[model samples]
Target: MAEAQEDEKVGGFLGWIERTGNKLPDPVVIFFYLALVLIAISVVCALAGLTALHPTQVNADGNPLVVMSQSLLSGENIAKFWVEMTKTFSHFHPLGYVLVVMLGAGVAERSGLFGAAMRAALGNAPKVILTPMVALIAMIANHAADAAYVVMIPLAGIMFHAAGRHPIAGIAAAFAGVSGGFSANILPGQLDVLLFGITEIAVEGSQLDPSWTMNVAGNWWFIFVLTFIYLPVIWYVTDKIIEPRLAKTPFSNTASADESVQDPSAKLSSNEKKGLNRAGLALLLVVGVWLVMTFGPGTPLIDEPACPAAVEAEGQCAAVQRLAPFFKSLVGGFMVLFLGAGWAYGSAVGTVKNHRDLVSMMAEGMRDMGYYLVLAFAAAHFVALFNWSNLGLIFAIHGAAGIEASGLPLPIAMGLIVLLSATLNLFVGSASAKWALLAPVLVPMLMLLGVSPEGATAIYRVGDGATNIITPLMVYFPLVLVFARRWSKDFGLGSLTAMMIPYSVWMLVTGLLLVVLWVFLGLDLGPAAPIAYSLPGN
Candidate 1:
């Protein structure tokens, strides 16, 4: 712990940078360490020839390290590492995946659409149902993909204040549900699709069946089951546990004027009312169209035509393909839907003068992500280099090997992994990056040890998510610090840490126990994904 503190305190220049923004970590300095450490590791691995190692053993799509390893050691190979690093910045999902999503999200956030909607939705719920309701909403928001973080955190406080509860308790409760119950949700989410894609890629590496379909629904059953389990526990902990502890703690006074009580669904003037009605009508039309396409056999939007079954069964009773990339792209299209709806409302209501304002809203939305883009650039490179070093793979292989030797039950092993990931969270924050490094080794290792790739992925999810709120290393940790400063002027790093530690400890224990139970019960973690192994990859 002291060493961790010292590490945070290191480099005299960083201290100066910290003074500039009490809430945000100096990304420039963090990136410096990320680059330096990763580069050093890459160099060492190159010299030792350890760069060639990959945990999965199956090669094709190859590990993230593959290109970097081939390129980093010799001067001639430099291009390989640079190429992988560059792709992260060019993220190809139209307006850049992360950027575009954040764009729409930012507008909804900036315009107070998210905040207002959250308060109105939660505030109106019976006070007794508040905890469970928040937990359920958190689980549902998983499908919206990180919008909960952008929208729910502040919304929670607002709703709690409006309901006469401790606002921090509200924040903690919502954070607990969104993050703590991350692996458990009633709906398929970005995680379901992302992990399924990766697992498919991993399975392809073994070449038994390169085209096996793993849909977002693979983990559906398990997640749905866990959602119910999480609701009560989250409610109990929030109302009976966390809230009591934080009762004496003053709520942070960061409420904005825009957040003041106002009925979002209030009666509008003729023009405004017309605009909102038009927007609502358009949304209904869009939804109606989508529903028909999804339900209709042989509809282009409903099936993956290229897949043999999809084509052979075209117009047949079993041709649904909800997990297709085009279908999944709808993930961010919510922004477009909202934009159209909002634009219509604005036009009729006179909130929008013209198309320029619409464009401006989007532009303004994306502008806030400039800092995130910079951070992602350095982070992408650092991750690329770390993959090149092969250290993560080495650690994964060793960890898996140790677990295999113990002859532990699958649940016990998964429990251990959850613990390991939670411990690592104390220092690491990026879930995707951490999982990218972890998945290659652990996924296949578990496959070898009688755990399915889906199961392994589920365990990894549980492990990664359970520690997020408590970790000071989390980028948002310092923001929580700033929130604290509003309530307790003397707030510092230690103070925020002390405040969260109890919540963190109890969550880590309860969440991991939940994972163990899921494994024992043979539940489906999500659609098509089973919780245990039926056969080895070979």
Candidate 2:
């Protein structure tokens, strides 16, 4: 009776969250509402004469330390707002980065390369290792962009059925890895670029060292560890928890062969095999070209300072940095890489017949980004207004002071940030949107606690991603439900949420624990990305 009642209590709680989450406006609408709220707050703060001493402005010509917080309603600021609206949307960092990366990714996805790769991954896997294989591949699919969802989720179901296991189990595991383990990629992908791009803007005037660069590869090592950890989490959840529950109520297949959903048991065509081989060669060639550019002949990608004479005299040029070229080339390099590999595969398979078809595929990728574009328009303006008001920096300063005075150890402080981000994720479904809003305050706030921007962003990803599988507000949640319905008509939102809650809870707990351990151990997050940071004087 106690066990049954406990299960009832769990169901009741998750039902409430699903209902509440569904009632909230779209993430884009929420940002608009928040922007209006921010404007109102800015007005009140400005009228009340609120201000913060600009931390970095202390030595600027011996000027006044106080940065008078400006009102969004102030006439001068109002004029700049209207004038820079277009510029704001265009300059929104994630907007361009995601778009450019998607352009090359579009061809790969549209050309059938991503699907062929998924089949090849699962087609030969031993049933014993299938769960981990799916989980690991899902993490790697982060690079394939939206193909992770469109290709991976359903294919997982199909593959599992062929292996004599419950198909819904595969769906759950793949979804967990794809969405819950979003940041667990072995290499930097579009998400890293998108998040760190915001981190750069967040640190604009807040950082003591103006020369510090926010590398997209900053979380590379940390995420590599996360992928291995999450692999077992998904494997355990799918087998020990999800599959057992599913065994009690086996999945029904009422459809005939003709009605089957894409024939999950079908073999890959010969053309796909050739396309895969060619895609592999194309990827290698692209890497070779980049390596040649990076390490051969004057290290062209290094962007060595034009002031070699000054460097020779002074031993260093203060302004010029070697990494600028490499960082700047990431977007273009990826664009070319995706374009080349995708076009090669598509041409081999005849999905892309000519250059024009490849162009169309790229355009399709842009068209698919329509929703994000809309969100970016609102988000760009919101970020811009916040910067103009200087409220973010003020909040960071006071928040940092408060957290420091609270005397939380560095690991504990980092854990709290992860919890805060996780709580916020329940309401906000867009990862980029959440980071864009939170990074401005959270990045600088943690930097004061001796945490690097990459470290803070890594914490945010743990919370944001862990809850993705369980949240109804996640755009893909409904899609996952539809996939579930394929095998079990009895599955509802409550059922789906309940099934995912364990994975969510476990991922968040273990992910945060790993983060805490990593912070205490002082592990390097990525190339030149440390677990701790110090401001210029500190």
Q: Among all windows of ten consecutive residues in candidate 1, which has the lowest summed lDDT? A: 63-72
Model 1: lDDT equals: 0.58
On TM-score, the candidate that comes out on top is 2
Compose the digit string of candidate 2's lDDT tens values, residues 1-538: 5543343332465667766877888878888899999999999989988877655556557863776678999898899999988988898877888898889999988998887888788777789898999888988887776778877888888778878888888888989999999889988888888898788878874644576676777898999999998999999999999989889766865421325345535677888888888989998999898888888998887766654776757855422256666766777788888899899889888999999999999999999999989988888888888888888877887888898888878898888888988888877888898998898889888887788888888999988889988777788888888787778766777777878988898899999999999999989898768878877645
Q: Which ranges in model 1 have alpha carbons more than 4 Å from their true place?
A: 1-71, 82-96, 138-168, 178-226, 245-287, 302-353, 382-402, 450-454, 477-499, 531-537
lDDT (CA) per prediction: 0.58, 0.82
Question: What is the TM-score (0 to 1) of candidate 1?
Answer: 0.70
Clashing pairs in 2: none
